[model samples]
Target: MALPENYDYFTREQWRNFHGKNQLNTVTGDELAQIAALNDRISLTDVQEIYVPLRHLIHVYLRRYHQLVEDKADFRGETVAPTPFLIGISGSVAVGKSTTARLLQLLLSRSLPNQKVQLITTDGFLYPNAELNRRGIMARKGFPESYDMEHLLTFLDQVKSYQPGIKVPRYSHQVYDVLPDSYDVIDRPDILIVEGINVLQLPTNQQIYVSDYFDFSIYVDAKAALVEEWYLQRFGVLLDTALQDPLNYYYPYAIGDRQAAFTMARQVWQDVNLKNLREYILPTRNRADLILHKTEHHVIDKIGLRKY
Candidate 1:
């Protein structure tokens, strides 16, 4: 594939050389197991080559960001503390974005020992299933309109302004809904990673976009067909786990004919996920500061760094 304008694209071999060796020693095998998403694979070598370089770049951004913060404070003639540096990670469903987000969070936390780092998903900002059903858009759950963008924007505003103890609604994959009365408290952190498919989306209804608060952003890229395969593979794993749990949202499908269950999964990938990716998510790809392009089996083959 041809590279986009304003981006310096590099093959994995070339990108790996940007960061020196021996960085993989920090991430252990057990940590890799914890960070990897279901049906997603990531090795320590990937960390040393791809993520380590990525982390190094983030540090470069952070240093510049801190200098600007001090410069702005000096212009106002008042000493001001630094606000949270927000990183937004976005991509299509089943594209291993969650894995990337979690991995980056861990890496940043370890490297920036003095700075506090926190990670949250925009899934928490999604409208409850009941609300979606009432709105007659339950079938289009992952669509841009299904999110409570106003609420999300408000939360991001608070975080960027250094608000403490802000609560984020909790979302449950097992129930496939936003859990009522459950929340995660985000104390003001030095750095925040917001990950979701809609992170980089521009909702027409909102005056400002979610990406407006981001100091840096990354978009995970992969072919639609490859994503579909990974989606189905993940669905199968979900079914296997749901088989023993009656409360699982997938329990009904897990108990039914396996072939029919897979058929439904494929249909969802085509009618919902694929449609959202093509129309909304992919269109925002060029807006990212960085892009990680993946090949077969979730291997990142190339990296794109925006020049401007």
Candidate 2:
């Protein structure tokens, strides 16, 4: 299917060529592995050819954003309030959104030596497992209804207000729960990246969509069937690696019947993740400032930037 209206579509080669021979991947193999998500492999060549241009484009946006804010402040005859440039990234479960977020965080931080860039995931804003159970939506974890939207909105509002020491809730992967009284403080970052499956979602409880805070946004795109395959592959890797810890949430699956484990994983994908992707996530793709379309092997094959 063709992309939504008002997009400037570019083949991967064409997009990479825009930067010409000046490109150089500054990150190392170790750094790539550090930022990469499970089952997502990105090479230094990909960084040099793909992400360098994208990073430069973001720099351009940031510059223009600062000027716009200054102009507004001058018009109002008020002191320019220091505000953050927020970027929202959204995508399916296994479409490699985390890796993209981490990669951008690292690249942006390195390039903008004077800027303090922070990356935050919306998983921390999810209702804790106990709350989910009480609400009878534990099975629907990761759905729009599963989040503490008010708390998230408050945090974002404070961040935009340049509120110093704004505390954000922290989620734990090993425990599979939101840690009680845990927070990651945000203190006046020049740029903030909010990446999540539902960052672009319009929640029923709020008048302001989360994307309303975003100066720029990205939607990672790929075929649903490919995402399912990627999700399963990631599950297997987690079983082999992360589940080795006795306290790991998926440890039971790692030690249980392998076929049954795979069955349960497949069931979760078909029932929860895929359903959320189609109903909540895919519909918001056209709202993104840029869409990165991935093909097999997790390679970004095309880029679609909104003209508006």
Candidate 3:
């Protein structure tokens, strides 16, 4: 199970061996089994092999963070401030980043009852459709340029400052636009999980990078071929279901011939998603605090934790 010397991340067998020795008391086998039953998307084997270990690792990190705060306060002779632990989750489209984010939020919250966990998607910071159309980057919706980086950074900075009742703008996928007056408030949570496709990518300038605000970051990694297949599958499912809704943003796409719809989805993946992943997302893998490397079946085969 030992990984190759040159490999920075764990292999599947290595992770299993590691987990065998450092099991946490927080979540039990029964609880994990129960949770697995709630979602058929991931198998029990994946949950035990990947997510259980991940949950334990996150708990360890949180424990260490609290200790560091205490140590710093004692050394500096000042009261320790309550700072939010920001964790960024980034991955390519259809790589299951959303699922990972949601699961982490659930696991982390259950690990410590007193700690508040908030999950925020970067979609809300995307520029309105009008702006994207005007900029002639409508086809580049998920690209880095499509987001309001300045506003996103500003919001993160305010969160770091422990600002009270901070409001975050909302984006509607149904309308594919930012809601003008709608917002959500972050009421000073202990941890914030910021999930997005390009969160790890550095800004061209120093002022507005999401990584600047992160306490820890994770990148979900898989081969481009696997992700492309998943993307196509998801598109097919959406075409069969959600696209049929009259109010669905992608209604027009759903009405197209199945073969035509599949072709269009592939083109979008190749031209836009894959391009952004290569130029922006994948390049930032080195910046992550941890990397979850997945197999062809979307099971996390190993974890790569950055050395201090």
Candidate 4:
């Protein structure tokens, strides 16, 4: 199949076939069991095709990074210093980027013996909902301007510098806001996975894209139609569960009729999510170091690796 500009092609069947042939050989039974334990919610097929290769690529990058540091130390006649590997993972809302980020952190930590791995979501850097309302961008909550980009960049710089116990502000989904006086400290780690919806996008001024700080990046890809369905399904699940909490910002959504709630969710996807994906997210696919293309079932069907 001919792919359009900046796109790569792969069939769903090919991805399944690869998993069938390679799954058993890639990891020991004990290791596979551990991966299954970490990913109890995801299917075994997803674990084999998507998570396995994703973990392998991250391991390869980690190894290469250590080698480079050692080589630099030898050439400069200086002591070796440990540096954190920053990895960016971006995808649309409800595209499972959070789960992927968590899984990668778990797998990578386990892959290395006695190494610390940190996972930080860019959601924490979003402007408070009140701030979004004041800016008249409440409807554009997930857009780039809704984020505290300068602070996020500063945090990344701190991580790069291997600062000791850097405190990061925390955002709460239940309140749809960054909490007051809520912060977590990230002691230096061997790997840091920064996950978000638009982490790879270049700023309007073209000064510094979030991808600039990444040692490696992964873009999770799926058809727009599939993403729409997943978004609605996720909304339904949240409405039945999280949104039911009285303190939840989305509690009102849970009280609505099921069909009405679904409709509202779809409209949000069309007007907000889809618009951002087309205008900002999709355009950055070409900038990824690796792309994980998923099928309708949310299983990765193929991997597109950029020529390094």
Candidate 5:
């Protein structure tokens, strides 16, 4: 596939050089293990080469955002309100967006020790499995229509308005459903990182997009085939972990014939994930402020910074 025309792409080596002299080495091996997603690989070297420079860039953006807010407040003769800098991270399934979000959250928190940095996934905004089944779209679970975009938009609006104690619905991968009556509270944060496959999507019939609230947005990119391989690898890991818990969503597949399980996984990957990626996710790649392009084994080999 051809790269987008709107970005100035760089090799990982070149991208590593972009980090100024003020890079901090706060993340250790133990921390990386906790931050990484299942079956995801991220070395400290990768952190120093890729993420550190990215952190510096975010610092630059955050500084400018604060200045803009202060200038606007001065011009209007009003006090500057607590508006959190919002960062959106989007990618196809198994592309390691959660890892990126968590790592950035840690980096930003350490760098700005006095500021409160929070990370939330759009999985929480997904409609319950019961609702999807009732709507007869269970097969299209990850599709745009399966999500409650209105609720997500409302939450983003509230966060941007500096609303305190806002509740976000919780979703669980163990049961593959939105937990009933469970929520995560968002108390006024200084920086918020929202990560999900749908973060950059433009839903039909909606006047406003989720991206509209993002001060900085990233899209994780990889070839569909590579993503499929990673997805299946992750499935294997899930099966191994789920075997100990009967209530796990993959319990049945875990206890079933291994070959048959992989066969079904491939089918689902092609029908559901690949379809969603080609139609919805990939189209939004150019919409992000930056793109992290990955190669084999989840290695981020290239970085694409938007020209505008």
Candidate 6:
């Protein structure tokens, strides 16, 4: 399928060739497995060919961002605080966004020797289970409205303004709930990767969007059918691991009939995750500065770069 008109589309080989003469650092097989999400496929060659070039692009963007800040300071003849470059990664739940965000964070941090790059997933911004129950959005957990949009916007605004001691709530996948008052502090960073399924969603009723603070954004793309397969595969893995613990939210599925568990996974994917992707996530693909289109086996076969 053709990409949107505004994009300069390139096949995988073509995109790989765009990496300049510099021999960029590559992730080893062990490291790839460490950062890779369960059920997704990514090799060192993929890192060298795809993520290295992407790191170079982000490096250029970071440099230009600092330069622009300096230019503005000079124009005003006043000192201004250095700004942290925020990058947003958005995609469907099972599309490997966590892996992508972690890859970019690692690559960017290593490539830039003098700066600190931090990665955060906005799952932290989700409302607590009790709140969701009260609001009657438990079934719509990953939907845009299910998130604490107001708090998310405030967090981003503070980050953009270079605020310190900013604490973000953490969500526990094992329990399938937000850990109340448990927080991750984001100190001032040179670059921050803010990733989530709804990161690139359009502006909501609020005057500001979570993406308004983003200087650059990425959308991971793949067929919904393939993503559903991945979602099921991941659920199975969790049953083997996370569900083994009685405290886990999925323990019921783990001890229940295996076929029934599979059935439930499919139902949740169709009713919740897939619905959110179709109504909210996929529509934001074109808004991304870059799109990574994945094919079978989670291989990124094409890249689409926006011309403007």
Indicate which candidate wins on TM-score: 5
Model 2: ten consecutive residues of lowest lDDT: 17-26
lDDT of each: 0.92, 0.90, 0.79, 0.77, 0.94, 0.87
Query: How well is each residue in 1-308 modelled by candidate 6, as lDDT tens digits?
Result: 24677999898898888754265665667887999998888988888888888888877787888889999999999897879999999999989999999988888777776888888898998889999999998889989888888888888888888899899998899889889779899998889999999888754687766677888899999989999989999999989885559999888889889999899889999899988888998888888999999999999999999988
Model 4 CA deviation exceeding 4 Å by range: 1-41
Candidate 1 lDDT, 160-211, residue by residue in tens: 8899999999999999999999999889999999999998888767768788
Query: Compared with the true structure, what per-residue lDDT tens digits does model 4 show for residues 237-266?
Result: 667775549888678888767788788888
The reply for model 5, stretches above 4 Å from the true place, is none
Cα misplacement distance, residue 287 of candidate 3 (Å): 0.7
What TM-score goes with each of the models? 0.98, 0.97, 0.88, 0.86, 0.98, 0.97
Cα-lDDT of candidate 1: 0.92
Question: At residue 24, what lDDT does model 4 achieve?
Answer: 42
- Please report the candidate that would top lDDT against the real structure: 5
Predicted candidate 2 versus true structure: per-residue lDDT over 136-192, tens digit per residue: 999999999999888888888888999999888899877889999999888989999
Q: Using alpha carbons, what is the TM-score of model 5?
A: 0.98
lDDT tens readout by residue for model 3, 4-115 = 2333677767776554235443445565445431111465556556766777777778889889988999899999998898999998888888777877787688766789
Residue 148 in model 4: shift from native, Å?
1.0
Candidate 6 deviant stretches above 4 angstroms = none
Q: Tell me the spans in candidate 1 whose CA falls farther than 4 Å from its real position.
A: 1-3, 20-24
In model 2, the runs with Cα more than 4 Å from the true position are: 20-23
The CA-based lDDT of model 4 is what?
0.77
